[model samples]
Target: MGIATVNPATGETLKIFEPLSAEEIEVKLALGEATFKQYRKISLEQRSQWLKAAADILERDQRKFGEIMTLEMGKPIKSAIAEVNKCALVCRYYADHAADFLKDVPVTTDGSRSFIRYQPMGIILAVMPWNYPFWQVFRFAAPALMAGNVGILKHASNVPQSALAIEAILTEAGFPAGAFQTLLIGASQVESIMKDDRVKAATLTGSEPAGASLAATAGKQIKKTVLELGGSDPFIVLESADIEAAATTAVTARLLNNGQSCIAAKRFILVESVADRFEQLLVEKFQALKVGDPMLEDTDIGPLATPSMLLEISQQVQETVTKGGKILTGGQVISDRPGNFYPPTILTDIPVDSPGYSDEFFGPVALLFRVKDIDEAIELANSTIFGLGASGWTNDPAQQERLIEEIEAGCVFINGMVKSDPRLPFGGIKRSGYGRELSIQGMQEFLNVKTVWIK
Candidate 1:
């Protein structure tokens, strides 16, 4: 199948491109390796300058780039614009702080002057997802490039245009010719690229299967890999939570990115004392959401990125209902729509053993559960095999501290929504995948942490 832009809103194909042949792929690999030789020798200051320039380009052309993102994957035009701005923020952040983050740290060992040095690890293969197309790639690109490591981006096939656009941005920003290049290849082609001797390490932000495949391949080759995969994050609202605020934020968090984000609140765990009120408020908020064309200014939710996503989400809903779950609203697909649009769905009384309980609802669906107390809330939240992120809403200081200490996720939010930021580490625990992204931990993910000893 050729890589094509199929507008998820109307299911129309706008453009297509054939995958690169073996010879072409080899040539690009060679270029990436060659680029790294000279690129890694550059100073952090020089790399930062180029990175900031890329950020400038992103800001200058945010509208155009944002439109491309919306057209390709069906995110709201407004959110797409925000995604672009966020990408720029990450770029500028790394550009300004990379020198400090990657600085050599002196160690007083053996009474001699020795220090640990941070270095780049040749060419990094980035296998990224399409959910937040630009943000995902830039988060990796900003830090990897700033560390003097060349990157070969094998972005999700559906977002080919975004991939090429990013490559263009880096080049125009004064990066060396092959410092960052988009490989217009298929998933079947990724392993061979990873096996290449010149490709030092890899990073992936995608599904569990994709992460497993890449991690296994990188392992067999004895190369390092960082995987940020799926999440079925819990959004816990205790009795002491600001019920109105928690309910409002819950709707926005669940419906974010049309519910395609890995970090979007998937499970709602409400304490029993206030569960009735919380559920009532949540239903009102969900019903009031405006789902329509993503390009429209007032649209609150957009279609799933692809038809397959719609089908998967619908199936999850059906399975949950069959297993004795109660649908409070939006149990069916929207009628008379050309795109993959599913109404925002809310299911309550879903059995803990139901399929939906363990599955990651990939679209705009929220699973509600009521627990007797904070301890039970924590129990239900930690039941999932995936632990990418979690959010807890409560005014009790002791409860908030306990939740933070007990929640099984890479990142935890107390009385607030969970979001990825350039200033904090983001990733997951358990089967959600290993390694962190964003912040100081993110920048260090693909770096060479070398320790020096003098005797």
Candidate 2:
């Protein structure tokens, strides 16, 4: 089957491209391997220059590319523009920092001049999601290329133009032909590509099932894999938290990427004393949001990336209501809309067995849970299998310390929302998927940290 770009806003198939044939796949694999052999030999300065050039190209035409992202995936135009700008920031960040990050580390050993050198392997396969189309690919490509490895991207099929746009940027920025490439094949084709000996490792950012399938396949081959999967991140608000600030941030955190992001706050666990006020503030904010076309500059919430996402989220909300939950604000699909549009929704008093209690809401739906105290809040927050990220709001030092120590998430924010930054290592624990992304740690994930000893 061929890949196509279907606009999430109108449910229209805008473009289609045939999947790569066996011969084409072989050509790319050979090119990836051959390119890595030559790329790894290139100077850090040269790679850095190209990365910067890519960043420059992105900055110059971010709006145009941002529109493409909005058209394909239904991200609000403003947020899409911000996403494209952020990609450029990541490119520049890796360009400036990769050398220092990969420099040799001196180690004490029996050998006089003992050190550890970081070297690139070969081709890396990145199976990325379409939520933040440009951001996700650039984050991987910038570091992978800067570290002297080639990347072959199997981006989510929904955003085929985005997949190709990335390759074009790298090409126009003066990178070698095969340094970075996008494969237009479907998910079924990913395993065969990964099984190839030329592809050294794989990194995925998608559903748990997809990550598991890819990881298992890679495991059988003993090829390393980095998986960033689902997250049911908790936004915990304690009695001492500034309820206003916490609730305000919660709106953005929960509805980020039209509530399609893996890291978006899904479960809001609130202490009893502050729950009512926080709930009131959250509802007010949700009601104030403008839900409309992704291309609209003023729209705060846009359509879900696909119609299936709309159906799934609607069913998730219905299940919770049936299992003893109350819809405080919005919880219905927009029937008149042509696109996959679901209004901002809030579900309160969700029972323990309700789907809202455990399942991740992949749209603009928020699950609110009331807890007796910080202890109950922490317990409820840690109950999920996903330990990706958590945001705790509290002014009490002891409570803050407890939140930081007790939250099962890989990353915790005391007062701010959980977000990915180039300076910080980002990833999750447990079922949220393994390994890390961003920072020096992310750059080192696919590198060979070889120990060098001198007599």
Candidate 3:
């Protein structure tokens, strides 16, 4: 097998796969371009119908699909199922709103009749990551396909089964043979795929380096690219916030996806007045979490997706400790387990110049920061290169308003956790990457907004 699946939960090489050869890749390129020609012509009503059918398939066998994700990437079985359901939600959302979102917008021009038509730009290459594997792909696929643009997915090598499963769903939903396809390829093969003249645009959700590589290659060709990269989102808790609620939610925010999530709240910024209480509550929550087999129904945190990820996280924690950061709760690996497991750890006394201060700790480790006031809290929140999302906890109306306006992130949640919603535009600024991925704006990313004038 050129492309294969490995069980992350047990550290077992369950299967191996061979990547697609150049010749096979060429056939897929031809197939996608040719299929898109007819697929784009299909009416929006028909496309919506097919997308809904795909959603139905996902919802009906969500547990089955969830198991594949869990087996591949080590997400807890419950969260894996939720990811499947969320994929269906995005598909249904795009299916229901694509028509309205893409309808012609009349232009005020010299011509008697002029409007902007959002027409599909043909084949798109999607390089999706393994975290929330199903959700990430579907969010892009739902909008891209609903807008009449065909997609070819080059999903993470570890989740090839999930990738193929997605293609199967689209086919079972009656999409044409090549309307949506999964290419079993590697990173070295992506640039060549994007080089195809028939491939109109490309989108990626992964690390900063990967995004830069794809964006650079696609830029040379002048093809459009949307990159959603890594994030070290700030979870700010002001003195006025509900300390109990904020602390409780902080645990979930940091440990989400076993802290593998790009949008996970790595920095916990608490105002000095409430720092001690928040830290105490948060530590309690973290320690109480059940860390074990992802297949277990009640496990709060699962193993990191891979051994390297586990080691990287452990090193980050130790570096923080070496640089004067104090561990308030758990630290180090849980060696008793077979899979890649790490204890939920919290750190404090980390100065601004500390190595951990600006790094995105992509694990179940939290770096705590104590702020003097609203001004300092806002400054600490925007300190990192990542501006993907932020959660500002405050009860004061004026403070909420300030946080909402001053936070340098694409999406901000006041008194709540930061997350992606199918209805809202999702993306980031600075090093976090650009381009929206959901809602009305997402559907237009790969479309030709042509101006039609009838004088």
Candidate 4:
């Protein structure tokens, strides 16, 4: 797709943006490198003040930003507003803690004095996604800017307005124009950007193919890169779990962002003893969801982010059914809708070879599997090629401990849903992608750790 905002709710093209030409991209890149030289000399206190002001602006105009997000990406207005607020929280978080995170660490050594200094790497490129446009970019920009590194955002093509809005917010909050910039560019232009020596390390959050392509290209340059890719996260409920609570949270976990989240639970594993009950609850809840315009206050579900997304999800569900997976609730697309709307769906009795068994269903669809015990639960949970996150429910201490230690995912929530927090390290292993974002680890991803010693 080209750089433009096409409303996913009504299939309306609200705005169009031209891709930045090669010359324009060069200007921004030169500015980023030049700004980094001066920006890194600015006091941490000054950077902190600017970032804190960003938080203030985000809070002041959250509703306006939220509408931009919803109009571009089809997330509900309430959730979109909440996402903007989260952007503010992350700005404040890094603004308050970045100085401590980047402080020189005194090392005990044979030399008279030794320490490690954290320093900025110039022009960090952020390849963000459309799912959580504002949150994803801020999580990267807040720390990068606070650490005195400039940023260049190559956001998803479909959310051009959201991308520009982010650049505007940062600039309005007293950041120099070069400190952060949005490039209205397509996927084809990314390789050229990475090839530029001025652009240092890079970070991306998107599909496996996109992440792999970027990583491969960056690897050739011997440059550092962080990737947060696809996930088929499992949600397990054992015999001892609170069926009611697990069932309730399961719906939200599966349908968040219209079921477009990478960490949203995709596979539901239930102990045979509770499988029937949990399955019934899930079906009832799925059938009860309200699917309509995302801008409506009472709508529970909205359109998929794009028509291609809608088509891919429908094909996956159909293939699963053809492979012997039984649908307990929704099994077809809502043809009456003018936009990309798919109802909440539940697939059970899945064969091992079905898409429901292994593929990450990136829509409002849930795959249910029945296991005999905790051993089966863990085994089934770890069966997927993706291992981004897992949410397990159990009251037994031993079972909980086993789930925590045995589950092969980056994150395991014992009794709740899997969600990203600004204070915690977030990322995954295996096919889900590598490296980390958020927390102290994320702040240091693109920094140079220099060691100094004195005899």
Tell me the number of clashing residue pairs for each predicted model. 0, 0, 8, 0
The digit string of per-residue lDDT tens for model 1 on 132-175 reads: 99999999999999998999999998899999999999999999
RMSD of 2: 0.8
- TM accuracy, model 3: 0.98
Ranking by lDDT: 4, 2, 1, 3
Cα displacement (Å) at residue 392, model 1: 0.5
Better of 1 and 2 by lDDT: 2
Relative to the true structure, how large is the alpha-carbon lDDT of every model? 0.91, 0.92, 0.90, 0.93
In terms of lDDT, which candidate is strongest?
4
**Model 4, span 385-430: residue lDDT tens:** 9989999999999999999999999999988999999899999999
Model 3 segments more than 4 A misplaced: none
Which pairs of residues collide in model 4?
A: none
Error of 1 at 237 (Å): 0.7
- Candidate RMSDs in Å, in order, are 1.0, 0.8, 1.1, 0.8
Query: Where in model 2 is the C-alpha error above 4 Å?
Result: none
- For model 3, the local distance difference test gives 0.90
TM per prediction: 0.98, 0.99, 0.98, 0.99
